[model samples]
Target: MKPHKLPFENRWSNGEHGWQWHCELERLGLMNVRAMFADHETRHPGKRAVIFDIPGGFVRDWLAFHDRRTARQQFLWRAIVIGLTLVTAVGTVLNLLRL
Candidate 1:
């Protein structure tokens, strides 16, 4: 893994249709990052990512903001898709009326 790659970046494993569903973590080298509350037993056996015990306040605030941002983006995309579909449906109905 490159030194600067984030946890959910290119290190993810490809699932069905090349979708990334999981990633692994390792305690490699002396680094600036820290892995807190890591279960070595589970890490080796399950090959799971090491848990990062981020502060509660950071998790609450950051995750809440991220969720809201993602929700807004999803809503925008859905609105665009629905608008296009409605336009297509109306056009089809108008064409049928002219037949």
Candidate 2:
């Protein structure tokens, strides 16, 4: 689905947090399909800042569904990673004992 765009740009000081906010907005179906930001001059004239389009809640249901799906996937991946780590640790210990 296409993302909805906001009329104005939202300014942020920290790029990482700004990007994360954009990602969350995209995940919530508020922004474009991709999270993007642009550099802009702040009201202070000389100060530079990053700006991202504010997201609109056009697809609330879709956003909710996506969030749930993402959460489930994240949980599954964490479980898999933990299980693999445990298996690897056990194998390493067994090999050490045999040697």
Identify the candidate with maximal lDDT: 2
Best by TM-score: 1
In the predicted model 1, the residue pairs found to clash are none
Clashes of each: 0, 0
Point out the worst 10-residue segment of candidate 2 by lDDT. Answer: 33-42
Q: In candidate 1, which residue ranges exceed 4 Å CA deviation?
A: 1-54
Q: lDDT per model, in order? A: 0.42, 0.49
lDDT of 2 by residue, 24-99 (tens): 6556543443232212222322433222343322223334545677799999999999999999999999999999
Please give, for residues 1-99, the per-residue lDDT of candidate 1 as tens digits. 323323232322223311211121123311212223223333443434333433323223333444576799999999999999999999999999999
Please give the TM-score that candidate 2 achieves against the real structure: 0.43
Error of 2 at 52 (Å): 22
